[model samples]
Target: MSLLNSLKWKAELQAITDTVDEYDRPKEVRTKVRDIYFVEIGITAEEKYLSQQAKTNVVRRIKCRWDNTISEKTNGLLIDGVEFNITRIYVLPEVREMELSLAYVD
Candidate 1:
C-alpha cells in the first residue's frame, strides 16, 4: 500500500498552554492543534537498547505527513483514547513527512 494509504491511525496533536486561574494558581490546559493520520513504525531492537541506555522513555514511533505546527513544544498526542507524550520529532524535507517518537504518559 502507498504510505499515505497506510496511515490508518487517527491522532490528535495537543499542546499545553500555561494559564492562571481566577485564584492565581498556574494551570496547564491541553488544547488540540489538529487531527492527523499516521502509521506506526516498529521499533528496532538496537534503537530500543540505545534509548534505554540514554534513559529516554520513547517506546513508539509514527510517521505522518509534514505539519509545520508540530514542534518540540507540542506536548503529546491523543490516539484511540490513549495519551502519549512526544519525545522527539524528525523531519524529512525530501518527502515532506515527519516522524515522531512517543512515550506513554504515566
Candidate 2:
C-alpha cells in the first residue's frame, strides 16, 4: 500500500507479561515481541486545560500501524527509547492494517 511506503520510523511492539515477585504479588511487565521498521509514525502534543484546577496538561498522540502483530490495549510501543501506552486500536476491514492511539508515559 502507498501508505506503507511513507513509513519512516522504526519501533518495537511489546506485549504485557504477568509475573509474581518474591512476595508472590502479581506484577505486570512488558516484553518485546518484535521490531518493526519503516513504520509510519507520528507524535504530536496538544494542550488540555483543566478548568476546575486551572491546570494544563500536554497530551501526546502516537499514530502507528498494527503490522500484523497481535496487539491489545495492554500492549506498549517503544520507539527511540521512549515508551508509549496504547490508548486504543482501530482495525480496518480484512485485518490488513491498523491504527494505534497512544499516550506518552513520560
Candidate 3:
C-alpha cells in the first residue's frame, strides 16, 4: 500500500503552554494543537538495542506528513486515549514527512 494510504491512525498533537496562577506561580499546561494522521512503524532490533543502551523507553515510532507547527517545545501525542512523549523527530524534507520516536508516558 502507499504511504498515504497506510496513514490510518489519527492522533492529537499537544504542546505545553506556561501559565501563571493567581498566586503568581508558573504552571505548565498541555493543550491540543491539532489532529494528524500517521502510520505506526515497528521498532527494529538495532533501534531497540540503541534505546536500551541509551536508557530511553521508546515504545512507538510513527510517520506523518510534515507539520510546520511541530517544534522542540511540542509536548506529546495522544493516540487511542494513551499518551506518548516524543523522544526524537526526524524530518524528511524531500518527502515532506516526519518520523517521530515516542516513549510511553508514565
Candidate 4:
C-alpha cells in the first residue's frame, strides 16, 4: 500500500482504539486490529462462497470494526475486540446497540 493509504488506515485505527478503557487496552497498537476488506458479488470470487448460506441474490461482506455506540440504558457498548461481520445491520432503539454476526470480507 502507498504511504497515504497506510497512514489513512492507521488514523482510522486509532479512532477506534480510543473507545476502550486503559484496563482493556489492546495489546497491539497499530492497524492490525483495524483492517477492512470488501467482498462483492460476481465481481469477485469471494461473493460466491459467502452467499452460499443464502438462497437469494448474492451480497457482499467486509471486515470492519463497525462503528457502534452504546446506550446508557444498554450498558455502553457491545461487539468489541475487532472482527466484525456485517451480513445485515439494524439499529435497536431499545438497547441502542448494534448487533453483528461473524462474517468477514474475503
Top candidate on lDDT is: 3
Give lDDT for model 4: 0.33
Residues 1-106 of candidate 2 have per-residue lDDT tens digits of: 5756766677888897789999999987889888765454443333233311333222344444545555655578887898877665667656355766555664
Distance (Å) between predicted and true CA of 22, model 2? 1.4
Regions more than 4 Å wrong, model 2: 38-58, 62-69
> In model 1, which residue pairs have backbone atoms overlapping below 3 Å?
none
True lDDT of residue 3, candidate 1: 71
Per-residue lDDT value at 17 in model 2? 77
Candidate number with the higher TM-score (3 or 4): 3
Q: Which ranking of candidates, highest lDDT first?
A: 3, 1, 2, 4
1-106 per-residue lDDT for model 1 (tens digits): 5777888999998997789999999987778878989999978787778777867777899999988878756478888888887777889998888999887776
| Candidate 4 global TM-score | 0.25
What are the clash counts of all predictions, listed in order?
0, 0, 0, 1
Listed in order, each prediction's TM-score against the native is: 0.81, 0.63, 0.80, 0.25
Clashes by residue pair, model 2: none
Computed on alpha carbons, the lDDT of every model, listed in order, comes to 0.83, 0.61, 0.84, 0.33
